[model samples]
Target: MGGKSSAPQVVLADDNSPTPSLPPSTSDDPTTSTASQQTTSTEPSAQLRPSDRTENLATDRTSNPSSSVQNENAAPVHTNQLQLPQGTQSSRRRRREASPANSREAQDRPSFDSLGPQGETTDEPLPKRRRRDHMMRLEGDNSNTNGGPRPFTNGSAADNLTSKSLNGLSKAVPAVNGSETINGHAKKTDAESSAYFGHDREEVSRLLIQALSDLGYSSSADALVQESGYDLESPTVAAFRNAVLQGEWADAELLLFGDRDGSEDEGTGKNNGQGLVLAEGAQKNDMRFWLRQQKFLELLEARDTGRALMVLRTELTPVYQNVHKLHFLSSLIMCPSTEELMIKAEWDGAHGQSRHILLSELSKCLSPSLMVPEHRLAVLLDQVKQSRIANCLYHNTEVSSSLYSDHRCDRENFPLEVAAELHQHTSEIWFIAFSHDGTRLVSCGAEGTALIWDMQTLQVIHTLSHTLPEHTQGVCFASWSPDDSMLITCSMDRYARLWDTETGQILRQLSRFEEPVSSCAWAPDGQSFVTGCLYKERNLCQWNLNGEMVYDWGRPHRIQAIALSNDGSLLVATDTENHLHVYNFTTRELEYEMDFKVRLTSVSFTKDSNYILISKIDGEIRLFSIENRKSIRTFAGQKPGKFVIRSVFGGADESFVISGSDDGYVFIWHKENGSIVEKLEGHRPGCCNSVSWNPKNPRMFATAGDDQRVRIWCNQTASAPVLHRRHRSTLSGPGPV
Candidate 1:
């Protein structure tokens, strides 16, 4: 609004016309000769070059009102006044061929300096009546007569002129500084023409868009021009500009190769990064332009129009508009055609921007039929931002640990969603165990392999498999010795093997097991271990480090879960019969019995042994006061009638418990009241079988399911997970820890 150049204007004119005429030419056609010689003067016509004389004749004839009318009437179609419709190749070609004679005539003329009434001067030949008409129309003016001024308001004409002239110039010549010369000659070094018609970033974008859209790379071009300020000189600006207007970014990319040049490789990345290099010394402030171009390039690579527009508004538009352009951008982003992942990534990445500011704007623009994930993410993002303490915790009682909290969970109270998950199992992980220091984790799966993972990096350090082919059917469970130096893996082959974790070598194998062992645990002193069988009558058995079974709590119902106290004096077990039995390791006597409302699938005790977390068949997790053998709290919000809780683990602090459900979610609950503290999503297509929190960091955890992938998540913010490792853990390392 502040710049006069930005405004468009047209002057009202009368019917009167008094422009001068030129002398006739000598060598051209009758009409050309007549038009060219109108500028003849007493000043030595002999001293002038032929081309110079011809240029003078053409300009002078165009300047003559009567000659201008004659010329316009004589020509079959005035190329100067032509406008080509978009995508009409035949019409544009016709216009190009039609103007050759006029262009040749203008080329022959010598440069002349003449002043118009309003301090406007031209060294090159001025446009004839038809050319003037074309220019007027290009500037959005069409009612003017031959050689007469048209009336229009300020701002309108200037703005239109600025936008369209740059747009036109870009279409005509895409090369840097290509249009700087006019009429076959360069203007004087100090001429104001250069400054008046100079191309800026907006102009460049406009040109880029025009070229891209014309060639069918409309999508890429659209991304380029959107939200960019009115700079036309930036090399790729116009291509990008036309793209945004047309919503044809993909087409813009195709345009560079002549509009779907090849039929076979359509929409492939083969032609990506085409012609992006700028020549040396192209422009002084090219870095800024390059960065702007780079942004569009990224959009092209990402194929994300919304993100590109967001970048343009937040970073590029402010340079011209002085105000943030995000309001306009949000509308474009909320368009239905955009992908949900791209939109969520944008909002998640822009957390520093106020949620109210971002969401309110989005709500106004977004449709009611928005994709479910985007809607959920938007709502969750807003809720998280509004809350004050949004920490998420997952507890693992086995190692007395909790995963890291979500860094972005800034809420008034803890959010009921787990922002992170960690899963690193290659095969069917039957058991998982955290090392003594909680710095490492070990897991055994059906592949007969044991993996050691560095808890801090969440990466696999070692993979162990028995060298002897005699062993088969795969390992079911693993437990790390209290000293953290040894790992024991139990397999369905009725064998328990001790391994040196540092070297991944088998140290000893105990083959005394009777049936397929489903679960195992290591005593705190590392002197003995326990194993439970899948059969209903195999009895929970305790074994010494040397491989001798000592306490065989004879066949009860199928033993499903087993655990030992820190002191090794108490061993607890649960069976398929929904009963819990406590055995005194020192006395070798069954001392206690307890019953639950439902068949308990699993059981985990808190680090202090004061509480236990039990997962039931009906999608419920019950926390119990272990010492008193009474139910403390129940966590029961599994999706109605369809999903059930699979497993539960008591965490380090005794304040949190982690549970896996059939609804593809891993939930963390406050152990004291069973209030859900967090819900971890991302496995929307698969049912989760198990979940475990990292002992070292309460905020990191793992989830495995029918998706055939294990995902490790590190909670970063309530808006989104910080790190999402999918399938990577399974391909590389430790089973599930």
Candidate 2:
């Protein structure tokens, strides 16, 4: 090992004594004198790590062996040394009533903590629990046999220290005046090296190491940390991390709040930015309470009720913070066994470091410079890939991004070629959608019927049972429940009906809408459905599964199409006058509004529910960022003159925008740039009214049109493209087109 600070070391103590006594105070009682002198020191004492504390204890004892003995009549000295059992502790009384501050100090400060292995104070604090910071920081004595940096070896925790990053990379080569000589030639130092593209070599190396480790290339990460002499964290931080994950609670508390004073602990300080911040007095007490609570709960789970009780009165109750939590923890004391205690406290017992998801939450307050932020490099790389995809006009692949090259997807990756056509609808097909699970397709048309087709079999599974006459009351649109168990269908006949998706049995028919019920959408909870219509009264009416109206949001906007955000937070309704009304679903309040001059065809939210995509009769699709409340990007290049041509977000990450056109073609555009990528022609000349993209299968889509056909399209270049099938056309007389 390169640094003893990373490992717990227990020096063999003498038979009769422990550590030396502190310098004698003028007062007879050391506790009284120590309490009075608190905060008198101009600077905070440099708090010791667990290993440092152990070493100090040993050093004190070897310096003055006679100080180990205790005098029964003398004052109880300030000590973190080994303690006698509860039966053996002195019952000496205080000379005078202690002031609140002295009492608080006595309560908060660490006293007889048995932080070592084997429940012995002098045995070494959690022996052999090395720090992750040391291994990553490249500054500590590494224990790896290969002489390379490793991550959380033996399940040890990360050190939350900011290593001397500035000097780490330069260690690779000795440079004078920023240049080093190699083979009688001058070379730029690592900091000035062109290989890293002008970025700090140390930063690049550290991030690379982190990325490698997260990507499961621990061997490669270690090699880089060793070869570059750059580590991911500092020693003190590493020790603190090790202590917490190893259940050495007091040790972590010391590193975080210092010895009774909330001051920044000293260690590696070469980080360029301000590191972890010390919270104010109240916050410090709160944080201390948090750590103590975890320690207390774990003690109860360990069946160490004696220690757990001591923690409750001394460490926890004295802090005067989170009284409710303190009361709750106190209630757990009644549990008779470890299992009962765990159940009552709702504690995740120490399962290595995982039990205390405590470390991760605690680390958030720490500076990334001190502790390597979790998955730092992976997060950055993902952001980069997303940025490239957002800027790329033709990026359309599910293939993972490679660091070797900038990301770009071939145009053929997008599903463009028509795979199969269904001639089930006899009139103009208006609305088509895939179920939430993508296992079936639901289509409605002027034929006055809605058909549910199993995608796997490509056959109509449930021709919706409705009593309307053919071509008289066209089914406008349909929505599937979150579970795909039931569906709601809106028709031009001023009614919307709920039906069982499996058997096509009518569950209920809502007759509230005086005008045609144009569009319907299901709540994410599958408990309610929202209907939009041409509007005789109000345009938006929410109805529960019991067939009763839940809420009739006021306003008489003639809505043509509507969609609820998958998250159930937002409800977007598009009106005939080209207006967009966005409502807060839970609050039933209008959040905002946006308008376009041309009539709106349909409205939908992005998969993430952050953006609203509204297709218009002007042959353009506009993307409005919900937060920004305005159009961020508008996609054009489609013809939607006569009929409502619905466009939708599709492809990986919703990277592509697709719509069916009046000219019997399916137009696909790069959602980022509105650049037309493909205009797929197959349907007999007429409007391709609606399109639905498969959520599960990114390379598949279905489109319906006036040609009385529902066409299934898939990426022709992709392997196993839609299992091509031959079926009877059923186009006895070219019904719609």
Tens-digit lDDT string for candidate 1 (1-737) = 24444322212111112222322222222333222232211111112333443454455444423323222112222223211111101100000011133333433432221223343434433332232223323221122221213222110111111111222332222111112222111222343223335543323344555566556786776566443322222223234334333435343332222222222323332211121122222221222322343444346335588677766766555433423333444444444443553364353222233233333332232122110112343354457633312233333222311224433322223333333344444455544556657687676666677778765455678888743576667676677787888887777776678788888877877665567666778888788788888665545877786778777778656777777777677778888777888778778798788887567777776776666677777787777776787887888776522432345453444446776666666677766555776676635545666665666555455555545455555534421423233223443432332
Clashes in predicted model 1: 102
lDDT of 2 at 447: 69
Global lDDT of each candidate = 0.47, 0.64
Which ranges of candidate 1 are over 4 A from the true structure? Answer: 1-426, 466-474, 536-538, 639-652, 717-737
Best by lDDT: 2
